[model samples]
Target: MSVTGTASDIASSESVPTSFGEFQPVGHVMVGLPTQGNVDALIDALHEAGWPPESLLRFTPGQSVEELQALVEGAGPLAGFGYEITLLRRYLELARNGYRWLLVKVDGTDEAAAAVQHARACHATLAVHYRRLVVEELL
Candidate 1:
């Protein structure tokens, strides 16, 4: 129920753990959206899907790294869904190149599913994979 892949060791000789269960952030989901145009509908859809206004983490191009980091950190870990920090950083890089991203964490299975469905209906992207927490145990 865990993966041993390091952020910098994607090709390293290590065991890649995998599992399915009530994983960490078990009921949360992240939504990606376009940064331009009218996003009010998408935001409204998210709220209608049970996501609180305070749970949204919206990032746009030209946003400073510190600002984005602060927003992500403020949303806390569970809201990160299954994306690793490295991957999140990569997302930021993409954003800098004109890709807008919306990151959110809904609080339950129904709500997460609703959000995902609504996102897809609205043409936004969704990520709902279960991520195992990587912990190092020395014996």
Candidate 2:
């Protein structure tokens, strides 16, 4: 899926998920960087590594904070029973601290692996792959 635009654009287009419930956002990886500069560098590195710009969506700290807060508040009661909720809370904390996020669409394991490599190289603070059945933390 070729989704090109700002975080708001992609989020509204439903190409990038605005929230995570149980087993949600399958086939994508969310990488969090400590700063906008780091996120930009990661995006550049990802492009150099063969990922198209269309496959990446960036979220500034303000956007992330808003989205994450809404996600937690709107989640179902059972959401508290899952690790997804915990991760959402953690993401909220990071967002509040000025961390930016990149949501990458990955078609398979190879793509996910490559994304993780680039994320680490760019000093990503967190990298989580949302698979069909599980959320795997890559860093």
Each candidate's TM vs. the true structure? 0.51, 0.85
Give the 10-residue window scoring lowest on summed lDDT in candidate 1: 4-13
In model 2, where do residues sit more than 4 Å from their true spots?
1-15, 18-23
* Model 2 quality (TM-score): 0.85
lDDT of 1 by residue, 1-139 (tens): 2111111211211211112211133234544455443245566666665556656545444453444454445444554564444455554565555655444555545555566667677666435433234311110
Clashes of 2: 0
lDDT, each prediction: 0.45, 0.77
Model 2: per-residue Cα lDDT over 10-124, one tens digit each: 3532444635443267788988899777877787777776787777877755567877777778789988888888998998898898888888889988899989998998899
